[model samples]
Target: MQAEIGTPEAVGLSSERLERIVPWMRGYVEAGKLPGLSVTVARRGQVVFSRSAGLRDLARGLPMDDDTIVRIYSMTKPLTSVAILMLYEEGRFQLDDPITRFLPEFRNMRVLVGGSRAKPETVPAERDITFRDLLTHTSGLTYGFMDATLVDRMYREEGVDFQTAETSLADVVAKAAGLPLLAQPGAEWNYSIATDVLGHLVAVISGQPFDAFLRERIIRPLGMVDTDFHVPPEKIARFASNYALGEGGRLTLIDDAREGRYAKPRSVPSGGGGLVSTASDYARFCRFMLGGGALDGVRLLGRKTVALMTANHLRGDLADMGQPRFSESSYSGIGFGLGVSVMLDPAKAQILGTPGEVAWGGAASTAFWIDPAEDLFVILLTQLMPSSTWPIRRELRVLTYAALIE
Candidate 1:
């Protein structure tokens, strides 16, 4: 909300062309593709456009508003990634340093070579899982929900979950450490729970609780007041309900704002996918990143660190990295950076974008992208789960980019 609003024409964008977004968004809501949604765009550090549509709570007849607080889910990964990098700037640890240097539990971790969920084979990891591997998602770790590999099933059986709040982050990460990895560390790029481990690292290295470190070092400093691990009682009214796509393309309420876990305090704040934020709050985040790690005269990271974080760090695109069968991103033309996905070849990715732009989305179809090259960024917030259920992000890129006139 602190962002100064500007006319699209003032920022080298065509207002008339931007209108193309209105009906496109309304059609999604009218067609029941989303419960509700919010979209915000900025060029050169000024808000050029923002819009919201549909219902935040269908049964309550509540409409989605500009201030609706929604679950950002995996979008939390980038914040966690930044948290650890702050420590990296402090010389707390080197990127290549073994994570076992802090959490000894990961020592002698094994990689799943051959197996069934009931009976498995594993080998000692060739090298220790490094901080770099964690940042780039080259870590051998896997998410239980992947359900594609034996190691993923192991995560389920062993209870290595970040989604549920009953288990603390310490407990869940410890569970992951004991389980077999899906690949050798740094050998493959699989979207995994590495950022959750990075959050724990931030705590251990800074001698502060993970959430506290983020709140003090990142959230508060960035002026993102509404961004937090849980929605407070006073803010619950503004929280948007979360929905899952059902059997017949119908929307089903999965979590209600009044009594959902987000409504109260929880033990494990999933650094991977637990934050609740509003359009304005997250726009500040995107602005901070687009501003090269600082905003409102507060610098959280140096210019070089931001550059390193946004640059592609993979051997090739995710396709070359043998990504697991389940990522919302296309395997080609996109590469993993420290915390976000970097555009490698837009032509190959077949999406409308400039190379080197960075982006990531949540499980709820919430997504954001920062184009350093263009000095522009866009954010979409909605309450539809299993983000893959729709192709909203791709279409938004074309609509947003087509409006650019300079």
Candidate 2:
């Protein structure tokens, strides 16, 4: 079903104030800080504000539109997490179940104790890596690009990067399994390829290819027709060019829309950071989550399951884990849920957001947040790489909440 488009006033927001987002966003484009951006806000299951600015392709002068598809990167985690919970609801596996139950490669996993990149001292893991550890990123895995530790360097040397198109997901997980973990299981939260491991488990449990299971069970059910691991031939023109700030602060083309890696099928469907989607398509997904895991008549998860997924699963302050220096958001007053971040205290976060808000973002400055308190959801899509390069997410949060006059 199509979302009912309504005036901002109908959803308890100031229409005049909502228009301010356009100029605010256009300023980033004008300053060459971003190539293009598209934003959508929905309240009470109705779209209140939608806008786009600048160009999707700088060279071709292609304008960004409502339907422009852009890489979502790490935002893919939430969807993969939901897929795992879906199988959990089907009695496939318990949240605390050892992952080695299915993948024996993970059995007797070891943790890095001390050593150089060439040779590392290791000790046996305190316990087996569990499904909860994977969902909350406490499984001790670490991404290579985000850190400079010996384990991270090991990840780099092993070709553990998610952007690769050559290796399969199974192979990637197998390689990671052979490496010593960055920490003991459930000891700390470290952003890693745990979601890709979950993706492999999804394939194993569902008896379907990872991409096929996502398309069949999640993407199609919620009517996210344009979301996929790759853009089809017909939709290539609508795919946006990815950009990164280069030397001297000029926009550099990182990924071309017409002939990029995503233009063709990829061998490894990166559940950690490899999905492309549009503003509308993702809004529908947010609406599904906001609707308690159902959209229209399709129900992907139970209401209780949705509640559990969004709740904070952390035992102590996220800061206790020695939060990664390169992380985009502050760890104080924030906790990891199944796949998203749960706001334990908006004031501590220094952001204008509600407590219990579930949110996540991608590497390309794309972000989304679901506020059950206000019955609201917002999606921001863009093509700028390294989302940490700017404070757009925080600015957008303030911009969105300030417009809620009601």
Candidate 3:
């Protein structure tokens, strides 16, 4: 394996941590586990290790560069969550306010118990799905395809179209209103398009398009040049090709022919899964949050708001749906905070990390975690699907934690 630090991007990181991360990156690529990756590590607002490895596109033999843009799917959620908090900090709305206050269709939402018809089982929600619930995933929203409950199946049959390339967020939410909710408001922890709902709310409250609001408030201020819901035609060559395993164990390039805002600008801005960002740019964002919401004099939120976003909001019995099988080497019983995953029980988590570490990932093999206790954040970005089931993410986290001298 080969390793080298290009140059010191900044200071304040232990040389030991930089030395440790280099080999893990080399080993991961040498083993042909990841096609290409961009890794960035930071401590107290300074970058320690920033490097790129492997080929961005295996077919065309495109070498991975520092400027490779990647799809950060659900990682966009934290940004959306921060946008919501910004509005909260502005006193636009309270966390406990019913979603119907902005989106009237959400008022008389019902839960689906049995069949095609809205069954005999029905009850008024004890409380409205709050802004806090949107952050915590306790709002009882289902992703439609992940869980195999009756409602999930119905979601697949009816809701899949709205998530497709042509459908807009408004179309998706309107369809969602027609379907029965998985549970009462703020009841169980179900991962769904709640952030998309927040995107709509951002439109309502800010009097601007969701994407426009994000661009004005967050993206432009942070100088995130390449971060956006769509990749412009001029920048298409910079976008990495997403890949997945196919029959006979051959690595195949996944089809990305789906349309709308991802490849080209569209009016429907998705807060849930619509963002393309580069490593350095996203690192700036993480640094802002890790530094308690202010970066380079641009404060998107207050320090206390940053704390509130990362706090453990899961009540007694209602937490994550179940412990997801991250990989053979790791098990996570983590719960959702506002927009990130909070490591609830380190002992039960069976991974290498401190408790209170806030983390989440994108669908395209990109993941990151910020450990406030250690004042450290690590980001790994790649363009591959089905990334959660792989062991590399856990191993990377384990090695990162092991490198800490303190």
Query: Cα RMSD (Å) per model?
Result: 1.0, 1.0, 4.1
Backbone steric clashes in candidate 1, count: 1
Global CA lDDT of candidate 1, please?
0.89
Q: What lDDT would each prediction earn against the true structure?
A: 0.89, 0.90, 0.73
User: Which regions of candidate 3 deviate over 4 angstroms?
Assistant: 1-23, 26-32, 116-124, 160-165, 256-261, 316-333
Error of 2 at 202 (Å): 0.2
Using TM-score as the yardstick, the better of models 1 and 3 is: 1
Cα distance off (Å), candidate 1, residue 89: 0.3
Candidate 1 local Cα displacement, residue 210, angstroms: 0.3
Per-residue lDDT of model 2, residues 40-61, tens digit only: 9999889989899999999889
Q: How close is candidate 3 to the true structure, as a TM-score?
A: 0.89
Candidate 3, 304-404: lDDT as tens digits? 98988887777631234443213112324566678888877776777877777888887777898889887878888887777753666787786666656
TM-score computed on alpha carbons, candidate 1? 0.98
